[model samples]
Target: MMKRKILVLKYSFLAILLILLNTFNVNGQDEFVKKSFTTADPLYTNLLKATEGNFKNYPHSFLENGNIKYYQIDEWTGGFWPGSLWYMYEYTKEEKWKKAATAWTNSLESNQYNTKHHDIGFMMYCSYGNALKFDDNPKYKEILIQSAKSLTQRYSPVVGSIQSWNTRKSKGDINLWEYAVIMDNMMNLELLFYASKVTNDPVYKNIAINHAAKTMQNHLRADYSSYHVVNYDPKSGKVLHKQTLQGFSDESTWARGQAWGIYGFTTVYRETKDKRFLKTAVKMANFFLDHPNLPKDKIPYWDFNVGQPGFKPDWDFDPKRFKETPRDASAAAITSSALLELSTYVKGKQKQKFYNAALAMLKSLSSDTYLNTNNANPYYLLKHSTGNLPSNREIDVPLIYADYYFLEALTRYEKSK
Candidate 1:
């Protein structure tokens, strides 16, 4: 009789512990969602004040002199501000945010035909993509299809990848790169994949698949760390140079580039349901999460190999100043958002691991260390993002895309709960 009583007591205690753990998880998610919107409300309002209610120019980042920098509709970052507004609208279902998002998104309509670069995905999809999610506007679909068509103009059958940049001289190199396909190009595949799904045309999806396969073949190192830029021979379709335009060195992995790879590959897997892309994404994510240089808070330095021996760039800045290196909250935001989606695709321990990592990133980003609560940079949300360290531009500043993905991660986290 005593033994039976003890067993019952032990089972009751275990059940109560499980209930407490579940409640704690739910409360934690609720806290993050509440804090995220509370901070975003003021930051976006300040952006409106700074811009004087003008939706023509998109907020990019703060300049070194502490002025808010604005980009034209054609700039690569043009979509993020509108995308963020759409996220706000989605979360609150407020007509004011919807109106604001529509106004900002309308400013980029001309970008539908922009074929000068491969960032049309970032420019058009991010803005219109989120807009279509909330409102079933036929015009949005039309614009997105046209944008996808324009993006295909950069795709080369020879290289089996979209050209990121036209013929241009890389920094510190005298030879002009005939064709460059960057890790960032992987992100643009989503627009193509979407186009394929909406229109039921295999052409767009085929291009995206070819690009992903080629990128997997050449852009990733053996350990899944990605190269920032891979220059190719336009005529021969041969890889001429595998280099870094934004990392600490040609051999070092740039944090944002790696984040792009993880997010991009995960997206491809989602669109195609191909196991190869999923495998690649898992490997790349593990590389990032397991890297030795990642900070305790999960925010990464601009480059993974910063201050590591023999990983110096030809730029003027000293690589030995890794301790003083700027942390990229943008990378953290992007990775957190991607990890949320990735967690849904996996099961068991991997799912828990990815979800926990995303939660940690959100916790750190929402903390005082990264969140901009003082309105010091009225136009941006999160701080400490490094845009381009080699050129010494926008280092340790609040970037617009950082806020976009941070809000996205928050919304995803709330939904997962």
Candidate 2:
């Protein structure tokens, strides 16, 4: 009887093992790759698809109810969307993408879209600069001029800086934080400067210069790290406070914020030839690079303060978790591009250090484990990027900004080669 029982147990064990084997695609292989997924593969693919790949049946932007929303859908922007689309266009000389981009460019009137925020540079640099580069459509120039005018109109005579996230409903009282200057604001300064050139107006240039100078003085700390926001008294334009509202602390340097600082300061240096901006950029870059808390591969966390054991995350913590918390390769990709640009301005040994660091970031992003081209979502390069932190979600997924910098760096390197 004991022997009989042992035989039954053995057969049952074998049957369970067989069931387990068939239950999962434990060793499933991807359709187009010899290896497994990497973080950057899907990002790379998305960029290509936005431009090149079979976009014939491309679905228009989807609505919440899951309907197709095509271009010329009024609220949808075809102008800003073309920034990535143009990348593919540049590569393939494809006219279809250009046609799509033009639909949005033709849609504009006045300077309405020129938002009263730091993202103006982002909007115009991508949309208008693209139009200027490819089609040389003179109308695009007008659109850019109008956009800059709208942006310049927001400059506060009292604060001596542009107000971000403002709502007009405040009854002449500013609803948005008046003293706030994000690292991304570095991009906005260019629009003012660019507008200055277009309209032959020095006021716009002065606005840009003053805002940058004020930010440099108030936003940066003695440690070379920086804050994400600076609150100022709108009347006197004096700084009331500086803090990291978007990051781990008013004091903690968010990885992406630091990346923005690096990119923004470098751009400022290029446009204004400000040695102080250059010096500050280098200081922050060193702080980022020398931090021992970064992942072994050099990619950073969504928050630089991430990964510490005592760091109890909050309900609003959206610092790029992938099953477990992971590093933000998007930040790494952005910094890589910034470092590349910064190297051009730096000299001798400093130049080599920045360049090498940038290349290292790119190399780390290119590794198999980081990109995800092999799996179903095979195109995005960087991974674990957050779209918004308020909801505490989109953990470890591809973000549009990540793709932007990744492709830009790739293009820059490819063109150089």
Candidate 3:
């Protein structure tokens, strides 16, 4: 009798799983064909013009005719935005699109890729990650796996979190103590999680959970605002410094980092069923919703805590002493995509509001005046974008990721509607 009951229970769970998969059409014929910004919509057309516009400089990379080409956006090999045009290809299925994505993915196989940043999600997941998961393109899976391995190998048992940026003053010297964690690293957790899934080893999951927990403990303030970086001892996992590497948050909150925290925690909650992570996501998201300083445009300045209207920076707070914060469309686009995901976890009107806010941001982003309508510039985006202002790269243009997520949010909005 006991054996029979156990069998029944197992089958019942399997039946429910079948039902959910059927309901969501998880294996349906339709792939998540990426959407394009370049409809009759001026936003997309203008972006193409802007990014492709300048005769001397174009942020171009791709494999074509059995060769790869990369142009210098500047001193930095900056603006590697394959993820942006990947979706454009999804919509059009043009040979050029495939060639472009293929070239970018192939180049890394021969070169030492940038492995030590929180932006693996922005770099790989948005491009190769999606390509493998949705399209079953085995071509990119090896690279994605290599990418995950690269990120995971950076993990230090002493710090108990993934090493984010490499701080090597010399070549071949591994004494790099400079460690920091950014909210953007949260999306990269998927890389580790995938590694765990494929290897059937639990180590990756544990590392992901631990990294997230540490971020919550060390990087966040009481009101759910966040700092951009937490420096730590790699040997002992000690907090060495909490600095705002990006925005206002050595003591103030970066709007983009806050958005990343909210979105990333929500993702962790989805994976682990951790109540604390879910609650933290809610807390930070609500803080964002409640801020009165957001412009009529839902898009935010790169740092919300800076330059509140009618309020002067304290004498100690000098805007001129530091670089003025930029308005980051890329950050806004990532935040909106996160909110769409968060809606899946809430109920009724509570869910509706989060859903609406995300939609509002999309509407504002793809607007005619805000979009990059200049045919001279081949990038297909509009307002509030900055790439490598520190390096004076693409000072204000429609970033590739901005275009990617803006398209993603619009597609998600289309589905929810």
Q: lDDT for every model?
A: 0.90, 0.63, 0.63
92-177 in candidate 1: lDDT tens per residue?
88898898899889889999999999999998999999999888999999999999999999999999999999898987875678
> Which of the two candidates, 1 or 3, achieves a greater TM-score against the reference?
1
> Which segments of candidate 3 are over 4 A away from where they belong?
1-36, 39-80, 92-96, 111-118, 168-177, 308-326, 374-376, 387-395
- Per-model TM-score versus the true fold: 0.94, 0.75, 0.74
lDDT of 3 by residue, 88-115 (tens): 5555667666655555544444222555
Name the candidate that leads on lDDT: 1
Q: What is the TM-score of candidate 2? A: 0.75
Name the better of 2 and 3 by lDDT.
Answer: 2
Ordered by TM-score, highest first, the candidates read 1, 2, 3
Candidate 1 Cα lDDT to native: 0.90
TM-score between model 1 and native:
0.94
Give every collision pair in model 1: none
Task: Assess candidate 3 and give its TM-score to the true structure.
Answer: 0.74
